[model samples]
Target: MPVVLLRLQEATGSGEGGFTPFSINTGLIFWTIVVFLVLLGLLWRFGWPAILKSVEDRERRIQQQLEEAERARVEAQRLLEEHRRMAATAKAEAQELIAKAKAVAEKERAALLAKAREEYDELLKRARKDIQEEREKAILALRREAVDLSIAAASKLLEAQLDTETNRRLVTEYLATLEQQR
Candidate 1:
């Protein structure tokens, strides 16, 4: 590496007065311009076209990727909206089911209440009929007791044995007349 550097310095005449970047040499400038022009022509003919083609292809690929990303995002948004609509529909159906169930339950409750009221009314009617029958029985028993006492008293006042069947009929007729007057 040192031998190459020494040869390069000797070629540039660095030993005479060190290298001066701003030095003017008409021959060196002429050769430098010639070489620069040749290099520029080569790049323009071959390298530039290849570099431009590669850059254009990269730009087109990037644009395609961006478009694909945008399409994917739009599809995702559409799916999200569809999902929300489905959820709303399901919720509405569930609420409707609940409302129907409540209506059915309310109807059943009303029917049960009506049945209970009917049963209570029937029991009350039966109780009233039984009470009426008991009252009639008590009245008949009292009348029979009154008739026996009257017959015994009449027998004692007369001081004679009388036909019991006749006495009973007479007393029964008298009591019936008294009832009609009242």
Candidate 2:
């Protein structure tokens, strides 16, 4: 390495223009152009195609990922819409069930009220019948009592033992006539 460096320094120093960066050498220029062309050809044959293929693969992968993301977004939106529709349907069904339940309750309440009214009417009719029967019994007892008293008073007033059957018939007929007049 040191020997090569010394030789290069001697060659550059012996040159008429020395090692000016801008000084052009035809041999150096020709060799540099030849080397540049060889390297360019090698890159075109091997390195450039490999680099291009890798870039294309990367771009394809990015495009596929973007497409997949778009598909997933669309699927998510569809699922969200389906969920919203299901929720609305469930809400409507619940409201329908509530209305049906209310209607059933109202019907039950009305039936119960009707039954209660029927029972009340039956009780009132029974009470009226019982009252009428008791009143009839009381009036029969009073009529019997009045008949017995009239017989006793007539017997006392006559001071004689009158035939009881005959007196009773007479008194009953008189009472019947009085009732008819009233």
Candidate 3:
């Protein structure tokens, strides 16, 4: 043990001179490079594939989310356009309905006015016909009265000593004159 300790102390040169800790040792450097190469190879074979796969999956997920958002935006825009078109169609239909209603109302008013005019004309015709009939009845009554008065006057004249043939001839002439004047 004492001999091994003396050899290790001589190898580090720590007995007679103070050695600089920053100085490179060739054998230690060679062993460190060999250990580093073995560790790098182990990590490349066992750990790198899983890390790379996880990163790629995360990227794909993000891209899919972006595509879904874009599709949603397009669908919203289409719905808005459809709503506007429907609103415009409804407005046009309402206007058409209003116009049709107005037309029907106008037609009904015209029909009512025409019916009133026809009734008024019929009433006027009836009034004129009634007036004409009354006038004819009055004329017939006046003719009957005139005939009765003439006959009475002739009877009185005959009682006062007029000839019957002359009285009858005068009454006939007077009746003819009255008819002509009428």
State TM-scores per candidate. Answer: 0.42, 0.48, 0.50
lDDT of 2 by residue, 9-122 (tens): 766665665764444567898999999999999999998999999999999999999999999999999999999999999999999999999999999999999999999999
Clashes of 3: 0
Worst 10 residues of 2 by lDDT: 16-25
Pairs with backbone N, CA or C atoms under 3 Å apart (clashes), candidate 3: none
lDDT of 3 by residue, 1-182 (tens): 76766566567766334443433467778999999999889888888878988998999999999999999999999999999999999999999999999999999999999999999989999999999989988888888888888878877866775667878899899999999999
lDDT of 1 by residue, 1-182 (tens): 76766666567765455664434557888999999999999999998999999999999999999999999999999999999999999999999999999999999999999999999999988889889888888888888888887877876866664556878799899999999999
Which runs in model 3 stand beyond 4 Å of their true positions?
1-61, 141-182
Please name the candidate that would achieve the greatest TM-score relative to the true structure.
3
lDDT of each: 0.86, 0.88, 0.84
Q: At residue 152, what lDDT does model 3 achieve?
A: 85
TM-score of 3: 0.50
The better candidate by lDDT, 1 or 2, is 2
- Span of ten consecutive residues with least summed lDDT in model 3: 15-24
